[model samples]
Target: MPISLDKVQSTAPGLVDLAKTAKVSLEKRNLFGTRAKVAVVMDYSGSMTREYREGRVQRLTERILALATQLDDDGAIDFFVFDSTAAHLGEVPLDNYAGAVDRLTQGRRMGTTDYAGAFRVVRDHFGFAPPKLAGGEKKGLFGRKKKVEGAVDVALPDNLRPASEPVFAIFLTDGAPNSKPQAVQALIEVSTAPIFWKFLSIGRESFDFLQQLDDLEQRVIDNADYKPIGSIDALSDEQLIDALLDEYGEYVTEAKRLGMLA
Candidate 1:
């Protein structure tokens, strides 16, 4: 995935005159596409019962349900609840989230938290386009034999992905940890794809677990050879998750339009 300065200059000759343009091309090789399969992980332990620090106590699961409802033909979404064990929130070929949320709501739930259990179940399920790495330096999305730096929906390893499509892992946690490194290492074995582990701090008291949570964050970032892209905070169920999902959807749609998702 080494940069081809000459190719960039040729593709975008107009930018060749810019300073340092030869060092790094502006053809935008860092783009994503629509075919991504998304996995949503939630913490459903007894500790998560408190308000999400932002004053949202009652019907807390409803907020997450609302986020799930936003997912549809856009991509594959697997909802999971983690406690002393991990439970699949819905059946496979699970397309719409609204119904899935309802079904999960009906399922009895209660227990101590086990982050490792969740990782064991869903980590390996994702099929992220491996970022191109050469001699260890990351290039961009890993997929497809054709080398188009801007191609977002690049193919992925069939053994790792659903069939060379866009893939993602979204982990929602109260940032509480029973076993730190072990839980994450297990997840690495479960799924070697790009995972966006979001540590959603559940309540004011939950903030005490931030360091443990940060350690887990570093675990993924350090192993993946990249930085984590989320934070722990008083939960604010202000449709932010939905907004981000929508943003991703828009990007995929646009990428598809530009032939990035193909």
Candidate 2:
């Protein structure tokens, strides 16, 4: 469900500033030309009810979609919502903004946050899960399976191939994750993969766990960063974009240095 030009013929009236801000910041940091896959993960806990009700999340989606429309040829974004568990809402085309947010708010069933579950959903959706061997397939001589010699590589379907593209996951939350240990481990595990997480915190709660993401040791690469944007009502487009991209430049440079990007 890629966003077609007709679906996003015009920007939301209130999101003009955000659209402008996103375009400028993304271009300045060279993110627009990176050709990365984009996904948005929203926190669907009870704490986020207020923000969602006030249309803050909707506006934020519009802003991000603006960036996706410019950067991605398909103009689509993989959208997910998470609380106790994570679920993919579906691809959000530019025209379906309101409907997508409505579905997220009305269909949420969990009341706690689990960042690990959210990450897992994204990994599975993108087919990044480790390949599993078939059951009862015993290895014969020289550690090779019966008649098969050497390692057998399975090719993924075309749709799944996008999983290999560098991913920029935008995680929106209001507080610290309930599953901190699992969440931290997930971040570490995905550090070597082609995914970078950008966490945006809403409200005034202390995201102590998120703040420590950059300092996590022994990671193959620093793949996550966080910013606490107190309230959506007070956020100007410039402020929002600035907060979201605060560490993006450094992340890109590191990814390139690691040969994760061309």
Candidate 3:
């Protein structure tokens, strides 16, 4: 069961409405009793400076925390940020999530976007090995050969690896990554793991690549979904919750069918 409403009311009163609404949505989608680890990957590239400064990132974190309260027993979200590289900032609990966005990002210089680097961080954090390419080298965008980290002679897909629980990761980005092929390969590598990635586009960049990932093949199961939020400030609480969870039910069903979720 999700954290009680009285608990949310006392712990994070600001999130009471969001958590209540999310509960309804979860029940509507038959997800009321489901359990999963919640995580958020924020974009810290140069383009996201305005978002951080304007409190939009903080707002987004709050909203995600609201949902996390309903999905995670610990009432916290695993946090990560990526620019040219990535790092885990640990868990942001409901009691201490108000200023997490600015507090966690302070002093970090924004650089180019590197999705693969962040993807690798998340994959390794969950104890999954990187997927090995068939020919020893994987060609990325423009057919250029790329070297991936943590690759080895493993013939089994990483998806077949044992995972203790399902992870629901929200990957928010403003624009495309610096390397498209690397990002694509990284997603394919973890396609079989017990992780469902929901890519939320927070700008007007069209997010063509993320959309393409929805149809990415060669995986044991479809483990991703993408939605374009355009502007986070303009979306209502109900709308934001819907965008975050609309496709989650299907992913859960598929994961259970494949024995990734119990």
Candidate 4:
């Protein structure tokens, strides 16, 4: 259905409900309207130092960072930079994250890979509709949620409903998570929305992991694409920022369409 063109003004009893009303008018195409919340999870492990391409080899980190800079998110961005653990480096309007992609890349690395742990941390901030959940089932961030009465009557589209809310995520990592397999499994099973992973093979990312994710494609949404730059020697400083922004903008647009997000 076409979104309502009129401004969706409201003083609803709940923020989520207000967002639902506003979403009706934001059915813009290709990210033309407002976007919802999005988080970019970057892996800063030492393994990212591997160089890829020919001659002037560039590290996966730099190449990935370049793509992040090109995508424009005039909305809000939850940018998290992680190593053994994760931290919300900055939260800002979309432009702020785009502008700061360079500064974020300059962060010192501790050379650790805790893929599972980092995901657990990122999951704390946002909520996504769980996959395979009936169009009615809902989940909050970190498995915290209270079932609603008559939720089945909400009438959300299958793709736009609780299982497909736009609270999307991009996991940009060099290798597999050092954390327990079970931990990652639990997060994946219960996350609020489809988790779109963007893998960057910085240094020997476990081939097994990639295959494992591929296997999960049916069970979960494997939106996590890969950018294998190998190492930093190949990418110029300029190229690094461009790549990151380009992809980041795409994530922002997708998030806005689902009511699960802002």
TM-score of each: 0.48, 0.77, 0.87, 0.48
Best by lDDT: 3
lDDT of candidate 3? 0.78
TM-score, predicted candidate 3 vs. hidden true structure: 0.87
lDDT (Cα atoms) of all candidates against the true structure = 0.41, 0.66, 0.78, 0.43
Candidate 2 residues lying further than 4 Å off, grouped into runs, are 1-17, 129-164
lDDT of 2 by residue, 1-262 (tens): 2233344456344444455566678778776555667889999888888777778887777777776664565656888888888888887775566556777556556589988888778877776643322233332211222131232322222232223256778999887788677776666556555677888887768577786665564344566777777776567767777777777667667667655555
Q: Could you tell which candidate, 1 or 4, scores higher by lDDT?
A: 4
Worst ten-residue run, lDDT, model 3?
Answer: 137-146
When sorted by lDDT, best at the front, the candidate numbers are 3, 2, 4, 1
TM-score winner among the candidates?
Answer: 3
- Model 4 TM-score? 0.48
Per-prediction tally of clashes: 6, 0, 2, 39
Clashing pairs in 2: none
User: lDDT: which is higher, 2 or 3?
Assistant: 3
